[model samples]
Target: MTQHETPERGARLGRACGADGSGTAVGGAVVLLPGRPGMPLLSPGPVRALVRELARAGGPDGLATHVVQHADGCPERAVDEVVRRYGDVPVCLAGYGSGGLTALRGGGHPAVNSVLALAPCLPDEKASAPPEPVKHLAGRQVLIVHGTNDGRADPESSFRLAARAKKANRSTCRFEVHSDGHRLREHRSEVVALAVDFVLGSVMGGRWSRPVTDALAAPPPLGLRMPLASGFGRSLRG
Candidate 1:
């Protein structure tokens, strides 16, 4: 840990690996943002595995991780926590579910090279709007990976986010849909492999393209958009 760096519980950083153990420290960093019902970073086993993958893949030294209080705290607090610890490092923001919501809310981090979200949750245009349009994330680079079978957050939301990013002129914003669910515990290796490819490619300036478009075109759950939150309706009425 760097001097004056405050660590989140279980927060530590190391290298990320490539096949055959040949990897370079591209000064890349990755932070995992937890989803709503805001579980600790350790609740899901995959996150730990992700960290281990980075170590094996040759990630930079001492990356910082943070746990926000559900989605209640200001997004700036999260960004500040990360910046305070890892200065000017190439950072990737990742979150699952509402954790993605919170991570997106944070802006103005010049060091963030990209964002990786899985099964992200978006507040209906009701509770509040994102500080910037979802497409703003594409201004840099973003990788959105969601399972087609996610019931809590239909994949369409992720598609809308991807479209927004494209509208923002982000050519590198890629979205991939897997045949799994919200947790991704079902298609663990497949999901992780895609994520690894995304991170490595994004950092190394490799050829970029949308990972899955046909899947993104798939229909959303029937009647899923009908139940608008009453607060959202009120906000519009106001």
Candidate 2:
């Protein structure tokens, strides 16, 4: 894996790490983002582990994986950089915490194929207010995974956003990690594995699991309310 940081005239310098340390990919590229600026979310944590695992699982054709650090506390700029990096290659946006919100916000990028938001920090809008604008994700697939007991960012807020997103994009889905917190470290393996499945199938030509398909196709609240059960990890392995 190779790492690099170049100064950009207007944007913050994004520290990027690649899976193979070179070249583009036919299987496509994934851009992982952190919630806050300077947080090592792109380092040797669950997201990084997911990047490594995805590279290994992407077959001989290989997948290009990148960790885009939010050096300026703006993950969308990181996404923008990754989109520019991959050009026509489909890009999957995966982000954690505040970065998750960034991924959803960046789903409108023309090059984006899918978005995986792991416990996003969404704005708490009043019930009477208009839903967040999600028309941009009209043709894109979106998956939101939030912890039921998330303290830092209210789980309800994400659910509301997901509901709104589902309306705009029928392919939108959300998974609830029961009793987990904002970090979702309790079931990190399960969460990461789910993310991998979503990215592979959505960004590349990989097969989509039955569960994923059902969630995306199901009507409204059902898909948005799907639970990441204890057996979920086993199901993915199977």
Candidate 3:
């Protein structure tokens, strides 16, 4: 794994990536939230690869990235720190497992233009409590990528969340990695490529592909159950 320098200020750092140093015109930043509140910067294989790949794909521009080692026990709160760190740039909040739910919760932040959830693991409602909030996502884009064969988090639950999110924000869309597991090991390349596309488009601003656009307009489960093929980086984008 490669090493990164820590900025002098803002949020406890983990892998401050790309043009984090002065004089680099950072157009946007993608903050990665791990499944847990904190972990060693690059210990987790998936998180490591994500930060590396996204940064590499983004090149040395406005696509700087950082990992939140400790979310103050709240991913939503972590976003506020991210905004302070990135300054004047659109932010894409992405998370894994339960952290994905955290990213969804944090999407309401004004600086966040988009939210991405990978194998989100949401907790069961208390039955007395209200459902997850979707209203706050009104203008922001949201994408949920779940593995159909995920053993940890129920894929259906994410679909339900996506449906509500889609209703609140017509820009919401989802993709299912057929037969993949929680780690999404089987299609890591495709998943990372697709994620890079989504985050970059959301941060730098770009049009969605026809399939994504169609899903955005499709009803209920149709949009929430869109398939993510092995070559989706190219095929789905078309």
**Top candidate (TM-score):** 3
lDDT (tens digit, per residue) of candidate 2 on 126-155: 778776678888898899998898889888
* Backbone clash total, candidate 3: 2
Off by over 4 Å in 1: 1-26, 60-75, 125-132, 172-174, 203-238
Better-scoring candidate (lDDT), 1 or 2: 2
Model 1's alpha-carbon lDDT is 0.51
On lDDT, the leading prediction is 3
lDDT of 2 at 232: 61
When sorted by TM-score, best at the front, the candidate numbers are 3, 2, 1
Candidate 3 global CA lDDT score: 0.75
Evaluate all candidate structures by whole-model CA lDDT and list the values in order: 0.51, 0.73, 0.75
**Residue range with the least summed lDDT across 10 consecutive positions in model 1:** 222-231
lDDT of 1 by residue, 1-238 (tens): 2233333322233222321112222344555666665477645635656655545544433333333344463355445545554444566666667767656655235656777776777655444655336545545566566667778886777666666555554433434444567777765665565565555555444433233222222233211111111122122111
Which runs of model 2 end up more than 4 angstroms from their true locations?
1-24, 43-45, 71-85, 126-130, 235-238
Task: Count clashes in each candidate, considering only residues at least 3 apart in sequence or on different chains.
Answer: 13, 0, 2
Descending-lDDT candidate ranking: 3, 2, 1
